[model samples]
Target: MEPKPASASRVEVTHLVMPGDANSLGTAFGGMVMQWTDLAAGMAAMRHARLPVVTASLDQLSFLAPVRIGHMAILVAHVTAVFATSMEVNVEVSTEDPRTGERRRCCDAYLTFVALDDAGRPTRAPPLLTESEDERRREREARVRRASRLALRTALTGA
Candidate 1:
């Protein structure tokens, strides 16, 4: 693969964490965070590709910190790359504590989505515009993640 100039597309959403999103441990549930991640990533993909996109895979999700109820949760997502009909979405989750007003990263993840046609079948997405150093760096990181996921799939499927 030729190394072209890298560029990424990104978006962010922020909302207040509610009691309904918390678990028995008094922290936001993993599933709830994952849900917001998907939404943010989908929005990013749609903005970049100008099409309806659907989740094809969630490559990985890691929880680094806890988000308490009544905190402000911010979800940021970016389109890291495109492989055939699939686009990789990298998402970061952060939270601002209501008590201390301090912000911290709570989760990070990579998700893959496929653009859909009017008929709901997989379709090609627009190429990402690379225009900055940050975009290039993200593309490099995406390449590494793509390789890792490929290796993992091969190991699991033995194919």
Candidate 2:
């Protein structure tokens, strides 16, 4: 498979936080943000793989701030690295105040996705082409994270 540039699979999505997405505290629900992140990450992974992809795991997630109702939630996602049939995606979530135009990072997450073929089996994904230093750094870090995740899984499953 031809290597695809990370820029080619980058995705940015925005959503307005409505009452339905908020909790009794008037802040957007954590699950809502997670859903948006998952969608954005999935899109990036599919773009990179050029095939249907499924979420394998959420390797890391951090909630730094709360997004209030009536704010705009912005999510940016891109492929960090590709490992055979699986790829890692990083998503950053921020909340923007429509009136003040101020943006605050609310959350960030790393998710793993597996590309699937028409037979619904895992398929190889294209290699990631990291052109910039930041991209290269992210790819390197992703490899370390992957190692940690694999160790944890082995410890838990004894496989």
Candidate 3:
């Protein structure tokens, strides 16, 4: 398959934070944010591969700020790298205050997804073609993160 540019599969999603999405402290729940990030990342991966994809792992999920209820949660995701059947996706989440129209990054996450065929088996994904210096840097960093994840898995599972 021919390599595709990361921008081709980039995704941006926005959600309104309601009371149900928040905790008693009036801030959005961590799990709710994670769910949104995962969905955005999955969409990016599926768009990149043009096949069904499943989340294999989520790493480096950091919650930097609290998003209060009534804020708009914006998630932007893009493929960072592709390795055979899997792809790395980076999701950045920000919260926008409707009244002031101010936006602040609240969360960031990196996720790995595996493309699947009709038979539900892992399928090869197209290689990623980074277009800018920032994309290239993200790809290089993804490689290091993948290496670390592999090392940790091996150490824990002896596989």
Q: What are the per-model numbers of colliding residue pairs?
A: 0, 0, 0
Lowest summed lDDT window (length 10), candidate 2: 56-65
Residue range with the least summed lDDT across 10 consecutive positions in model 3: 56-65
Clash pairs of candidate 1? none
lDDT ranking from best candidate downward: 3, 2, 1
Order of the predicted models by TM-score, top scorer first: 2, 3, 1
Q: Relative to the true structure, how large is the alpha-carbon lDDT of every model?
A: 0.82, 0.94, 0.95
Q: Write the per-residue lDDT of candidate 3 for residues 1-159, one digit (tens) a residue.
A: 999999999999999999999999999999999999999999999999999999988996778989999999999999999999999999999999999999999988999999999999999999999899998999999999999988887998998
- Put down candidate 2 lDDT per residue, 1-159, tens digits, no spaces: 789999999999999999999999999999989999999999999989999999988966778989999899999999999999999999999999999999999988999999999999999999998999999999999999999998998999987
- Segments of candidate 3 deviating more than 4 angstroms: none
Measured with C-alpha atoms, the lDDT of residue 63 in candidate 3 is 88
Task: Flag clash pairs in model 2.
Answer: none
Model 1 quality (TM-score): 0.86
Q: How close is candidate 2 to the true structure, as a TM-score?
A: 0.97
- Candidate 3 backbone overlaps, count: 0
